[model samples]
Target chain A: MEPLLKVENIEKTYDGKKVLNGISFEMEKGNTKVIIGPSGTGKSTLLRCVNRLSEPEMGKVILDGQVVLDKTVEKEPRIDLNAIRSQVGMVFQNFNLFTHLSVLGNVTLGLTQVKGMKRKDAVERAMIEIDRVGLADKKDAYPALLSGGQQQRVSIARALAMDPKVILFDEPTSALDPELIGEVLQVMIKLAKEGMTMLCVTHEIGFARSVADEIIFLDEGKVLAHEPPEQLFSNNSSARIRTFLKKISELYGGE
Target chain B: METSSGLMIIWESWPMFLSGTITAVQLCILFLGVGVVVAVPVSLSQIYGGKSLKFSASVFEQVFRGLPALVLLFLFYFGLAELDVSPLVAATLAMGLRSAAYQSQIFRGAILSIDSGQMVAARSIGMSRIRAIKCVILPQAIRLAIPPWSNEFANMIKDTSYVFVVGIIELMRQGRYVVAGSFGNALLVYSVIALIYLFLTYCGLFLMGRLSKKLAIPGFASAGAAMERI
Candidate 1:
């Protein structure tokens, strides 16, 4: 079957430095694809480009057979940015929940405004998502009142509330306290078990190993290796991948 | 003897004094309401509107903020009268327009102070740009704007005295009229007028202080309280 999302030869530059240099990848439906790399490896940039938050200098991003970023296509290319964004929900590293809004408000905002649902119906749906993340009790609380772990869980619930076909997580647990990381990872593990399509950029090799169907190790804006977690972690195909895996293993754990 | 006469003057002039104060308060409230109505949208446009629109809004803000309120009132009352405009209309326009400019700056600062992440979060969740700004950004920005807006309200009340130049018989104008009619009781009249203005300003500040306390983020309040103790 064709991939759900295809990124072909995508390149991006910022002030003469190449961030994503002709990088390409594909994600199948209901699979978790983890892009693992060190800082400044352009993992976030790659995700941004795929979500069209940042325009790629060159290449095409095709989602469900729709050309998102094909420069050579038409004179006045039609891109429904909001539609693409709705289809691909993103969870930020900082858990950028609206501090001004209640947890339920944050989750139901898109449903009421974008999807044109009734306020009552939106609240009901939002409550279900909040309950899914075990934050139903805190639904009326603002983000400032929540713990970092709870805030991240609320962020996930907010994303899930949109009912997107694919979710993108950019270092979802990196900003959390070490003790809180387990809760967020557990949430991700549950989502993976339910077969949610996800492309996560993370440093949590353990979460990646436990949840990801495929691992893509990136270095210097290029995909150094792509394989199943078992082969990618144990066999170590590329020298860079081996070095990265070794360092991560030491930092996180063994196995 | 003079102190006794001053007391007698105040007692005798109580009705006129009370009427003038009431009119002045009414005028201040009216102008503030008009100003806010004009300011909120203009400020939003200035912050989120396109470059050309922002530029135009900036020009409107500068023209009103840069000019003295007295000068603006004079320009509206007298200058526009030259073109056959009514004095009351000119006074309303001048006060409302000038207050709009000042209030816009207050709102602009408040809007900018909000985290950009909020807007990003709203948009990422499928809200259109306009809807996100309306639902997410404006509510927080307006809440944060309350403190500065109270300052603006205080300024507006004080500045309503400028409408006296247009011969609109508000408090200051009434004071001038009473002093002139009372045969050179300028000191007594002006003192009463000053007291009235002070009372209005103090009330505004007091109300705003309470509002700010209520609207402040808990973290901010705790930090501020901590700093105050230190």
Candidate 2:
């Protein structure tokens, strides 16, 4: 079978500086890929480029055998970004919940507005997702009233409600407090156990080690190593990778 | 003249003042109703439209906000008189047009105040930009705009008095008529009219305040009000 999401030779720039230089990756169905890197290493940019949020200067992004983005084409394939995005869910670092809406409203907005599902059906599906994230009781509450973890969970439910083929998580737990990170990680681990296709950018080495099928260590817009957790963490032969791992362990220990 | 005659003059002139109040209120509503309608597009264009559209919106804002309301009233009333535009229509257009410029700025500020992430989150779910604006952004922006937008109501109501220059018999014009007709009892007549003006302004503010309170977001209180509590 074709890879679920394939990103080819993605390059991006800010001003005259290259941010993502010739980055490429592919994920098979049900595979969970975690991207780990220090700040400003184009990890987030790589994820954004997949969805054309930060348009790549040169790239081809294919999702489930469909060409979602082809930056090489002058007039490109007239694809609707909204239609493409509807199938690709993105969970942000800030939660980015619609503050004006209730938990249930936030989860169901895309379903009702984008998918044109009936109100009753959307509510039912949203309820299931909200319940799955353990936020069933807080459906009527607004984002302001919820804790950081709860709000992030709601955002996750919002993305899941779209029934996306693959979910892109951009540091989903980086914004949460230390005590609150476990609940979000637990939810994600459960998704992984159920074989959800996920592309996550995070520094939580503990969650990553336990959950990632393969971890891609990115540096300066290039993938330094792409290997399973045991090989990269247990027996990393490269001094640069070892030094980076040591610094990350010292700062945010592998809990 | 005895105080009794002064009271009698006001009592007799009550109908005139009442009619004047109605016209003033009518004009105020029309100007602001149309002002808000015009402001949405103007503000959206300034913030989201292309270069020429943004420039046009900015030019409109600058020209109208810089010119005095009285000047605009005169230009529309007398300048367009040859075209058979009535004083009322000219006054409405002039004041409404200028109010739209001010209101557009007010709304643009409110729109910008919304988090940029709101649009991203909305679009990530497949919403078109316009749909995101209508559903996710504007609801919050309009709620946030209430306190600032209310000032426009008060400003336009007072500005409606300028229409008297073109001979529309609104509140201020009726007050003048009352004083002149009552043999220069300017003190008593003007006092009653002032009280009436005060009453109308207070009522408008009361209603708007109630509306603002009703629509305010739970945590996102108006910055000025929140600052006061702190």
Candidate 3:
């Protein structure tokens, strides 16, 4: 079976300093990949490059057998970048929900505006996803009214309402209180169990252990290790990966 | 010494003053409507449009902002009267254009004060930049712009009095007529005139205050607007 997404030799530079240098990876359908890295290690940049949020100077990102982004595909693109982005949902570290819109409005905006679904149909679809994230009761509440975890769930519902082929989560729980992290992680774990393809950048070691099919360790814009969770956590790993995991578990384990 | 006579003159001319006030209100509404319509696109151009568009918007803003309101009225009224534009139309257009320049800056600051993450999130969910701005950015920015925008409303109310030089009989002109027709009552007549202007300005501010309270997002103050107040 073909992979649902393939990223090849992606390279990104900012101010003449290389951030992502020759990174490549692939995710098959129903696979959950967790990316763990230290700060400014190009993990966020990699996810952004996948969807062309930050234009990578060089790379090819293919989603579901279609080239979503490619340095070579310029001069006339077959697919609209907006269309490509619509298919790739992203959740941010700060929740990034529309503050003016209610939870339902936030979820339904893309469905009605981007997909051209009727308002009635969009509301119905949005409610289903909102309910899926256990936010049915907060549909009418604005982002400002909801807690960070609640807002993040609403953002997830907004993304799910789009029916994306893959979802990119960039530290989705980083801004939440320690108590609030579990609720978001629970929704994510449930999503993984339902076989949604997910690329997550997070430091949640336990969540990675339980829900990730594979964990990809990135350092200095290079993929250092890509292996199953058990293999990555075991003693056989490289000193770099092992040391990084030990430090995080020590730091985040209390939370 | 002449207070009763001054009061009497004002009482007698109350009908004219009332009509003048109505006209002033109409002018304020007209210019504000045009100002907002012009401002939205101008601000959008400065914020999101290309280099040429940004340059043009900046130039338009600078030209109008630097010109005195009286000069703009004179330029539009007497200078352009050969174009067959009525005094009322010309005056409104001049004020509206100048107000648009100010409004555009206010709106652009409000839009910029929004967390850049909002735009990123909107785009991440498949919104084109235009769509994201319209759906996500403007809604929030408009709310944030209200306090400063109301200040503009009050400023425009006072500025409408400048049209008197072009022979438009608005509030200030009406007050002048009352003063001219009376003797030894200038103080009383002028006091009443100041009161009327105060009343109108307060009404505008009160309504805007209510609007701000009604639409305010909890815990979200427009940072740019707050700084602008200082």
Candidate 4:
């Protein structure tokens, strides 16, 4: 079967420096794909390119059989950007919640505005998602009042409120405290069990190993390795992967 | 003790003074209302409008803000009289245009102080550029804009005195009328005018203080409180 999302030879350059150079990947439907790399390896850039947040200099991004980003197909390229954005929810490392709005307001904004749901129905739908994230009691509270974990959960709930086909998480728990990280990871694990399609860039190797259907190791804007957890973790395919795993194990202690 | 001159002046002209005071208050209200109406959209255009528009807006802001209000009023009332405009219309245009310049800066700073992430979040949720600005950005921007806006309003109150140069018969013009009658008692007449101005300005500050407090976010209490102290 054809992939749900296809990226063909994407390349991006910023101020004469190549950030993404001839990168390619594909994700099947309902599969959790985890991308791992060191800092400044253009992992975030690659993710943003999928959504056209940072346009790739040369590439094709096909989502659900639609040519989202391509040099060809030029009939008002700006058309349906918001539609595509609503369908593909994204969570950032920083929660990025609007501090002026209540938690419920933050979650319902998209539902009412984008989906054109009535206020009452949107509020009710938002409350259900808030409950799912275990933040029902904090619905009226502003982002400033919530903990880092709670804020990230609210961010997740806000994204999920759109009922997106796929969710992109860019280091969702990286900004949280060690103790708070588990709450976000637990939420993601629950999402994985329900077979939600996700593309995540993270440093949490354990969570990636446990939840990812396929793990793609990236380095210097190129795919270094791609394998399932057991095979990727237990066996050595490349010296680079072996060295990366050893360094990560020493830093984070893998069992 | 003098010769009942001051007493006669008070008795015979009290009605005129009262009527002048009423008109002065009306003038203050009208000028402030016009200033606010012109300021909001001009401010938004400067801050969120694109590069070329912002450049033009900044130039407009600097030109009016740098010119003296009395000079602008003279330019309007006298220079535009050849164009057949009335003094009242000229005063309103001059003062309101000047207030728009200063108010735009006040609002621009407030809007800029808000987190850029707010706009990003609004866009991510599928709000179009106009809707995001109208619904999310402007509400918070206006709320944050209150303290500086109050300062602008206060400045407008003081600057309304410049209308006297165009002979629009506002407070300062009324004071000149009293001084002309009370010839040697210029100090006493001007003191009464100052007291009236003090009353108006203080009342405005009190109302603005309450409004600023109500609009301030809890997380921003310290900054708002600091501004209040200022």
Top of the candidates by lDDT:
3
Q: List the residue pairs that clash in candidate 3.
A: none
What DockQ results do all the predictions give, each relative to the true complex? 0.53, 0.74, 0.74, 0.56
lDDT of 3 by residue, B66-116 (tens): 999989998999899789898888987899999999999999988988899
lDDT of 4 by residue, B54-134 (tens): 788888889889999988998898888889888889988888888888887777777777677677767776778788887
- Candidate 4, DockQ to 2 decimals? 0.56
Task: After the best TM-score superposition of candidate 4, give how far the Cα of residue A3 lies from its true spot, in angstroms.
Answer: 2.9
Q: Model 4: which residue pairs collide? A: none
Q: How much is A127 displaced in model 3, in angstroms?
A: 1.4
Error of 3 at B175 (Å): 2.1
Question: Model 4: number of clashes?
Answer: 0
- C-alpha lDDT (0 to 100) for residue A123 of candidate 4: 98
Candidate 1, position A166, lDDT: 88
**Evaluation by DockQ, superior candidate among 1 and 2:** 2
lDDT, each prediction: 0.84, 0.89, 0.90, 0.82
- Higher lDDT: candidate 2 or 4? 2
Ranking by DockQ: 2, 3, 4, 1
- Predicted complex 4: CAPRI docking category: medium
- Ranking 2 against 3 by lDDT, winner: 3
Model 2 score (lDDT): 0.89
* Candidate 4 wrongly placed segments (more than 4 Å): A72-78, A249-255, B2-26, B220-230
